[model samples]
Target: MLTPSKVLDLYFLEARCMLIEVAATLDRFDRAVDSDTNGDGGDDRIEKLYESLQVLSSKSETPDRSEQLLKLFSGPA
Candidate 1:
């Protein structure tokens, strides 16, 4: 029932905050990687984060990104 503008008006600030938090986390991670001595910067979890970010940015017709992200972060059953 919500129009596109209405949806943005309701959720834009929250969504923007989340995005900023994610970016900040990534920046902190990059700093850690730069300061790490052993050079083992990333693991499977980091890879999953990167993949989830990709999913968020994908230009698919269907609005299934949240589903894709949920599955991406899920553990083995």
Candidate 2:
């Protein structure tokens, strides 16, 4: 059976992997935005996503649970 710490470790690894995947996906969207020139409001949305990803990628000295929860629930900004 997995200990609590082990479970938490697994979850942490999973979260990191998920963040990497999201960053990759954002990169793809960024490339698409660069190529497309229709300018049909997609740029705004992509910009927001990129900003959020940047926040996620930031290395904080301490884990801000409240801020993370707020961002998770509030959905951008």
Candidate 3:
């Protein structure tokens, strides 16, 4: 049986997982853009991605949600 708290926790966890996935993808893109050559223009895209990741990292800092992923993996809190 799923209690209300458990349900909420599950929802939160799911949301966190999605956010982490997004962050990871963005980070990868940013890293890949490192080799781009365009008179600093390409740097703008990487910078934007880094900023987005920073926001995601901050959002994933709640009590039960304070992890790299929403609770999808057994990792540090």
Candidate 4:
């Protein structure tokens, strides 16, 4: 059985991880956009970026336990 503090800790860890994942996803999309604008190999990098952006958007909008986590973390910030 997990204690309340342990569960809270896990929630925070998960939220931070999710934020990191979102940042990395955005970075990847940015790189793909730059490559598509510059790549001459007809690699359709822009298409890949659009796909990634869609996924990232969905992830950002997904509702999970993170909303509560953020509220708890933002103690009067």
Candidate 5:
């Protein structure tokens, strides 16, 4: 197994890049003219996106954040 330092060294930049990309994508969505919040403009996938972001940020008993997000997205359609 890689040491903590090694893991960070190997994955930090890539992870940071992905994080930036995700943020950019969300920002782009918010900027779209058709994304007006006049009514029920959101759906389950958007809700899940935010929920998964929360899962990614939280400290929980589950060590694997991806798995938690997967379950969150996969549960009950």
Candidate 6:
């Protein structure tokens, strides 16, 4: 039986590996685009994807319980 910490560690390791693969794939795509003369909207889309991933990977400051409750009741801004 895995402990909670062990499970969390496994999950984190998997996530790290996946993120590394995504970054590498993105890098290759960017290089291919650079070699091509045709300008598609792929660059913009890739940039947005990268930004979103960065946001997802970042740690956010936790709100207090009162703030969390207020948001829960008020719904998203």
Per-candidate alpha-carbon RMSD to the true structure: 1.4, 4.6, 10.3, 12.2, 2.7, 7.4
What is the alpha-carbon lDDT for the whole of candidate 5? 0.82
**Model 2, total clashes:** 0
Worst 10 residues of 4 by lDDT: 64-73
Candidate no. 6 TM-score:
0.55
Please write out the lDDT profile of model 1 over residues 1-77, one tens digit for every residue. Answer: 99999999999999999999999998988999999999978778878888999999989899999988998898886
- Candidate 2 residue 51 C-alpha distance from true site, Å: 3.8
Order the candidate numbers by lDDT, best to worst. 1, 5, 2, 6, 4, 3
Q: How well does candidate 1 score on lDDT at residue 18?
A: 99
Evaluate residue 23 in candidate 1 and report its C-alpha lDDT on the 0 to 100 scale: 93
In candidate 2, what are the lDDT values of residues 34-60, reduced to their tens digit? 788885436466665666666666887
Tens-digit lDDT track for model 5 on 1-77? Answer: 99999999999999999999999977876676376767555567777888889988888885899877778868586
Cα lDDT, all candidates:
0.91, 0.71, 0.61, 0.61, 0.82, 0.67
Q: Considering only N, C-alpha and C atoms within 3 Å, which residue pairs clash in candidate 2?
A: none
Q: Total clashes, candidate 3?
A: 0
| TM-scores vs. true structure, each candidate | 0.87, 0.50, 0.38, 0.40, 0.79, 0.55
Best by lDDT: 1
- 1 versus 2: better lDDT goes to: 1
Q: Which residue pairs of candidate 3 clash?
A: none
The residue-by-residue lDDT of candidate 6 on 48-74, one tens digit each, is: 565656556556586254444344445
Q: Which stretches of candidate 4 lie over 4 Å from their true place?
A: 1-7, 38-77
Worst 10 residues of 2 by lDDT: 39-48
Misplaced by over 4 Å in model 2 are 1-8, 40-43, 54-77
Q: Model 1 reaches what TM-score against the true structure?
A: 0.87
Q: Which residue pairs does candidate 1 place in steric collision?
A: none
lDDT of 6 at 44: 59
Measured by TM-score, the strongest candidate is 1
